[model samples]
Target: MNETPQKSQELKKVAECLYRNGNKVYFALVKVRGKQIKRSLKTDDMAIAKRRLAELREKAERLHGKENKNIRFEELAENWMESIKASLKPKSHDRRRVAIVGLTPFFKGMPVKAVGFAEIDEWRRKRGASISARSHNIELETLKNLLRYACDRGILMDNRAEDFKRRKQPKAVVDVLTRPQFQVLVKALYASPIAVASGAAAMVEFLAYSGMRVGEAREVRFCDVNFETNTILITSGESGTKNHEERTIPLFPNLRNLIQRIKAARPTADANDRIFQIDSPRGALPAACKRAGLPHFSVHSLRHFFASNAIENDVNFKVVAGWLGHSDGGMLVAKTYGHLRQEFSATMAQKMTFEGLSDTPPTFAVVRDAAA
Candidate 1:
């Protein structure tokens, strides 16, 4: 016989603890006072049951620390994740959630205070074998932040995850498409009926011309582009810009034409409509590469292509940096694109000459003083 959840005695709703009791009511099966208890929500309405579930879970979590000071790592991680999930971007929140999921298998029942550098080091060494240093570092950082949060709340005396060493990663080489290769890609895009109709060619040219990331490009709306000024506003999206700052890039002639073509095709599109309806630009790029018979390049390569061309053309580094939405003015641009500038310098180097220096000594070098 299922009894209704009492409205009195502070018996409240919560998460992770409810079930349907046949067709009559929802049952709350939760741990209270270290013992599992089953109570009826007495409502078949899912919304009411869910509201009660959240309340129950929150109440239980609040009492967990007071009931037992030595909480398991998994339990503490769940509590910590809930506390900070709202503050993180969706992608970032998903990453941290995954890190927590990966963590529980190793530290599931370990007491928070018992976890230390040795355990973290072992996890790092084991995890590093399967993933890149960057990913490994992120996992370790996630664990470190969780433990740091626990420390701040007085749940633990120290943050042992902090002592785990991060792997040093080398800077990756920026792969860019040469002018001839880019031209080949464009030709291939136009040649293929499917590619041309899909608008992949226009996207490639847009990225190459504007230096915007594929994500940023995809987020751009019709209203974001200003034909009169020849500029496009890059705004934050679901994951936000890399640095979380919006910027505008000048609409170079090629890019401007591409946008114009798109607008002409969709004259009825509202200003709020996304310029490109394609879901993933990179997924569509490989076909063009296969047809072009050139090495497959990611969409990001087009950004590098833009930067390389800008540097080769002697565009001011700061201007290029701003166009690329980099906050460091041109420092990172100089480091990454400086070699192209050097290539230009090398060409100029060949043209240099000391006008006064010659194999033959100056005509009057042997100053025969007639007076002497």
Candidate 2:
């Protein structure tokens, strides 16, 4: 009889701890040290509410007799951004700052610890609907990093955002210009009436011949190029290369001649002066492409053209990767230009013959008849 009564009292207290609000959402209300605490479990299901109630109760008991500093998500985000500011480049930092701005509105007043799968999923469904998968994934990555930061500092026991997977992105295609097409485009640029067409033409040739990024190309000074060693030293100003390290690339014949010609034109130019006068050929490049009846190509397309041309010409991927400032030892180059290699191999395969076989290769009709 006494056992039944004690169980009844316990069940009643448990029932009182959890209740449904006007919106049919379950909320956990409990008393800690004579002060009442209430939190929305953010669910309508009774089973989930009960489980969350137990977690809330345990957390409340642990935090008892201590100052409850419920830090807002925005506050923690700011701290995390500040902590990483010194380690990232300005553009990188700005991108993360933009991600934070997108995240803050959804989680403004929510406590860092209170954010869980439900809140995260809700935010994802709402946010992912409006943005591209790549953009959404960036924001999601930033959110996960912030939660992990909070966990490291003991603000939360776990990073609930850790298990959330990112959306799949589509495969990207690399477009490049053929040698003849590039020559025509350059000629068109030179023939254009634009005041900057001459400088833009030179810049276009420099990018395609040297395989340097626009940013890195803009920072190349005359002193950085060594005609004696037949090499060009790539050291983008204060920030360095994309990998933050300087590298040396062989000055190929075309690149060497282009630099020499430019130098000859500016006979009194100082070694400290930049190699290219213009930063980019954005305007001239597109107009030239249109005038030539060719596809519009950006500065990056020229870099691709360099890599494609090199691979097709039998320049090894590792060497090309070094010239392009990729830290990965030829992996990216091989992946991007593998198709070209295949085509090259197929062309070379046609010339091969067995010692006992006829030197003449089988024609398509002969192969078709044999197959039949």
Candidate 3:
């Protein structure tokens, strides 16, 4: 039964200094430094509620005379950002900083301990109106992490932000190119009058063949290639890969041939010289797609094409994930390309049939005659 506002606000004593509201959610109502403090345990489970209530009481007693209780949300957030800055990549740090900046206005002057579900809900309602769900979720996560940090430091009793659910995000559609479509695109790129078309064509082919991200491809040098071992070392500039580790992918046949062709054109090129001169094929790619009479394919589309082709060719997901610099032991690969694998499986299934099912099946006439 739904409780009226008056009934829901009424607290029933459950145990010493612990109470359950009409809705059955437990709360801690305790006194600290001669002042009454009320905090929700944020759970209905009896055991969990009791434990959280005990923890809350202990925190109040321990921080009775401390100045940590007075720390503002802005100060806590700044401290959290500073603590994480050294551990995160520059781009990642910047993203988190942006999230915190978006959150600062609503939470600025409030004490860490004073912020609760109402404040968080209000922030979510206001923010959801202006930004995409994905962006709001990022800021929401940042808020939760900041509160978690405050809890660890005893500046706040519990992370109230955890109780709020994140907004739903739209599923991403994976778009890739078939071999014929890719071939036509490359051909059009090569035939284009644009001066950078040739280089752009080379970049497209390199990404599709090597599964290297645009960033990683930009940093590849001729010296990184080992023709003897048929491997190409992928070092994405000083920052390394997205995961900050260098990986070596097999010098695939097409990739090797592409390199050799480029090498032939520039015999005097230094070993340190990068294979592709252009930073990105953005302009060239769209132009080539238009010329080829195909839909526009981004640089990332080439990466997806590589993964789709690998799955179609029966390459193991773990190996593909390794080549793509994923550390999750193929879980991400399976999630993204499992449908492609299913389509490939369906195609392969058509080749299987009972030998006797054919209209011109081989007869056992000799054996039957002998038996007769």
Q: What TM-score quantifies how close candidate 2 is to the native fold?
A: 0.75
TM-score of 1: 0.73
Alpha-carbon lDDT, every model = 0.80, 0.85, 0.87
**Which model is ahead, 2 or 3, in terms of lDDT?**
3
Looking at model 3, the pairs that clash are none
lDDT of 3 by residue, 191-289 (tens): 876724348878888999999999999899999999999999999878678998999999999999999998998899999999888888888888788
> Which pairs, if any, clash in model 1?
13-52, 13-55, 13-56, 14-52, 14-53, 14-54, 14-56, 14-57, 15-53, 15-57
Number of the top lDDT candidate: 3
Query: Per-residue lDDT of 189-289 in model 1, one digit per residue for the tens?
Result: 87877766777777888888889988788889999999898888999566678778888888899888888898999999999999887754676689889
Tens digits of lDDT, candidate 2, 1-372: 597655433422237688775556787779977869877788878899999999887766655133324888998998999999988888888999999998888899998879988999999999999989988999999999998887767576557888799999885788779889999998888787672334788888888998998889989999999999999999988877888889998999999999998898789989999977777788788888999999989989999999998998999998899889888999999988899999999999998976798878887743456556
Ordered by lDDT, highest first, the candidates read: 3, 2, 1
Could you give the candidate ranking by TM-score, starting with the highest?
3, 2, 1
On TM-score, the leading prediction is 3
